[model samples]
Target: MISHFVNRKRELERLEREWKNVPSFVVVYGRRRIGKTRLLVEFSKNKNTFFHTFFEGTKESHIKALRKELAEFFSDEIFLSLNDYYTIFRYLADKIDAKTLIVLDEFTYALKGDKELASKLQRAWDHHLSKKPVMLVVSGSLIGMMRDEVLSYSSPLYGRRTAGFMLRPLGLFDSLELFENFEYGIRTYMLLGGIPSYLIVASKYRSIKELLKWEFLTPEGFFYDEPYILLSQELRELKLYFSILSAIAVGKTRISEIGNHIGVEARKLYPYLENLIRLGFVKREVPVIGKKNKGVYKLNDPMLLTWFSMIYPHKTEIETGVIDIENLRDELKKVMALRFEEVAKEFLVEINKRERLPFKFERIGRWWRKGEEIDLIALNEKERKALFVEVKWKDLNEREAKRILRDLELKAELVGLNGWEKFYGLVAKKVDDKKELSEEGFSVWDLADFKRFISLRGEV
Candidate 1:
């Protein structure tokens, strides 16, 4: 809708290249309304393709609709209508006699409605469509269904895809371009992440307070029912998960404390916490370099975090006016700024990927153990070496950087001999103009470094 501008250029290019290759099946996924459909369409505009959408309807009705759409692409094939769902595969085999692009959008819907869809697809593809000479794309919105129904190792269509794209929200740097100024841009982004719909509603040059009054605090607003809608789609036991999220957003992260605060036993909350982490809305952290089981969780989505931390709890305020709305709003903003440190670490993680440290890292998480903690930890498990990092949101004066360096030196010494080979990096959002960073003992990074990482072709 917005001219499909900026970011994901590499992904588009790769997709285009694959479309021209010998038979390739691609699975494209992301949260709903995230421009996944727009991207697929834009990339396939001039290509010979069959695109179809599945919606909430009976299986026979969907098959009839799909056959009708497929018939649009085939001029000579005597395909009046398609039945016996398996015949759709036969139809494809007949139609793609030459090279073609075939798109199945909202595939999760089909799989949801017809439990045998993946097996049906597998049969059709293997028996009739595999060598038909075409590029195939299966895209969906319901993340859990897409993974378990079609992509899991045990699924019928598993391993059929030549490549897959797990499309993520837009980057903050490119995302900020929608707003007029840095302040509104940041606040808007802080709340909305990079989801296209949420960003479309963000006001330019408005104070955070004005934005809430004008855009958010309303019945018809974009985010008014967002958390509920998102949660309802993704979670089954929604209330407990939401309660835990609200507790963390309100600053109760310790296992015992969050459990006590939310009236959930610590053990019962683990599944919800794990799910939140997998969804990228919440983070679990341990005290520096701790194991997976030994960490605390923090609210990772600032907007939703702020929403639950402030807005949700104040639902009655709209009717009763029992709370000081302005004070609550101000406190929410203050706490969010404090939480921006975690956001900064996420930015640094992206930079490390671009640098391509000597090791190939499958996962990069932060670490903390006892009195020692690194703001970011990039572990190249293949090489068994880790990059411990310090991230500062403030600009580092010469004195400040020196002090950080000294403290790092002490920590490194305490970490012992093997820690020398463990790379140490320092990152800041802003730093005084002093010198080029690589000259220093530690690898230094800032916003420029971050922008450079995403700029790399095929990097994201």
Candidate 2:
């Protein structure tokens, strides 16, 4: 079942209203399955429009397709004989005395053979359609191309666009619409992320585990090549990127450690890491509360992380139908547990960006020194203060959490906050509700408090 389109009304309204303004060209782009088409469809449902998706076709082939669309809308004799897109756009600009919405999906593909296509469109807009009553949307999936060709500083359309949209995957709240329960579903979402196309194939009818199996195990399943499809466009060294991403997914966060596992020099990995960061799939961050140079990196796309950690290593098992679900369960569950706390951090940080925090920190990250290690550090960069947070998904028991906290505090003391402020913090699967926090003199942010922090602060 499709979850109700619960958010992004503002984005929708902005696109809907674009026709009222001059220079109404919008560039909407994102990674595959991120609902770019859906958002447009949602807007298109309320308008009169020309919508065309460009893919896997030669320029002549695309022109022919455009001709067919024009022929059907106007007539073969009137419009099909036209060869140039500029002329067609020029002519159509006059057809509508009122608002018209034109969606050119996968616009990069349309411009692939003709690097001058953006320039051509600009000429058409300036010479003819500039005075027309229309809103034009150019959408694409290749982020590098979209940014360089359409949105780049040197491109002809650089300053011509009235609005820009890079649609993102659905969030934690959106997942609630997809699942009946919170706990089990969060884990599933941690595996698949918020890609709409994946959600289309994920079992809305079955248990979460069953859906995951269908997504990853069954040879003919829709998402069998989903991760590969998404990664191929953005990364050239698939194996190395896979190894590094898998290592991170399975729970190593440090650069040196990830390099060690991937058998690459840390210096060699920088370009790949930077590309992933730009693609919005991975992140490099320093402690929100600690030293600026001491930083860690993690996979930002939950599905990619989950795919590399669990799916890639288990591909052979799925191929032979020899996969033991129970055996797979034990191994994947272990990986999941290791990665779960990191997911908790993302869930926390995503929420915390929305508002003022009790800690009032400027940054949040994992921290390590030549000797000491800490799970999380949130620094109030302005105040020069820091909060040390340790997450426990394994030992929710009070004594176990307390032991972790004690070690975390010791670790924090070893690495002085570079003459900044001081605060010790602990986070867990379930903070010991019975443990009197103010009495203990240690500030504790339990799961509820962490979730509250996110809810109150997460602006985007």
Candidate 3:
């Protein structure tokens, strides 16, 4: 089991600083299982805090639940008579004479039954909460809904927030802490992404193969039905969203391609695509130096991409126990191979931040031209310098690495960085003669190098 929290030092520091200024209204939100609740709990450890988790139910039921929690906390039956969110919040503001922390977790669920609660909250904060020495934190999982209903310009609570944070998944180095080895950690990351809840669960398994078997192949596993659960919470057009995601998963990136696969017109798919983009599941990508209208849509969540690509289509066979690890072996490799490109991009960004690259690149992303693509590209336009890279998940020997580098040089010319001093790099699962290649003026890296980089940073 993992023994400690990974890298949330920056977030913790910000929370502490915010809490020092009493009457602080903080809004915290992110995707599900991203550790927002855990962060708040950790931040509240030494403070007089009242934490309430909102449930999905009617207003009366939620009010009843809140009343019970308040009665127990203050040891007063008077709270039992308090009805509605406005009264309870007013009571909280009035009763907290000293500095105190109040957390309303899953604020989306709380507002589900009472749409007017936000406006009520606005009035409460204006009349009482703003005057009290209380640090109030509200967190939610439905990012789209939270932004629209609470953080938007027309939102009642828009101007009331003193500070807010849209939490993101942990980075690669922090995610590596959940596994016994870097190889397994990287594989698990490709499948589950950097969501801490999934990482912690995967950490218990002896190997990534076992984790995939139990969590993905089994119908009752936590991740088996997670996409459906998460998507249905924020989206109403489930069938269309699934179709679009499945199309993108299977290599249909362009709007025309996806629309054709889904049997829909491209124009008609705009709303659905926009919603997916807004929800952070699908991203539209254009070549770093290409026309915006000629972009493509791709899955942004590795976990969701894996599910729709592999498990969703074969759910029946998996659920009936007809499909086993052997059946999934090749498909797993394919998924990992695609995901490794993204991992390689991340690696480039990290090394760039550390100034480990030959040049400090101002921009980096995948670059492509008609019928040609570069796996990774880092460019410093003002300096007229560029780095073209090819990422491979297979083991490569000296000759094979050299061949890839030669091909990468050919691709680099098509990247439209004419007159720029160009460089070539290669990343693979394992390289036979990395030192020899580096001596030859190519930036060659392997899995072992990544592990060394991550490990050294962990120590420091």
- Per lDDT, the best of the predicted structures is 3
Residues 360-388 of candidate 3: C-alpha lDDT, one tens digit per residue: 99988887777898888888988999999
State each candidate's clash count.
7, 14, 0
| Residue-wise C-alpha lDDT for candidate 1, range 327-406, written one tens digit per residue | 57565655555455565666655554566554545566555666576566666555667666676756787667767766
- Best TM-score goes to which candidate? 3
Candidate 1 collision pairs: 287-368, 287-369, 288-367, 288-368, 288-369, 289-367, 289-368
Per residue, candidate 2 scores C-alpha lDDT tens digits across 297-356 of: 877886776566666788898889877456567656665665666765666566456543
The lDDT per prediction is 0.71, 0.73, 0.88
- Please say which candidate is ahead in lDDT: 1 or 3: 3
Model 3 alpha-carbon drift over 4 Å, by segment: 458-460
Q: How does model 2 score by TM-score?
A: 0.85
Q: After superposition, how far is residue 158 of candidate 2 from its true place, in Å?
A: 2.5
Ranking, TM-score, top scorer first: 3, 2, 1
Q: TM-score for each prediction?
A: 0.79, 0.85, 0.97
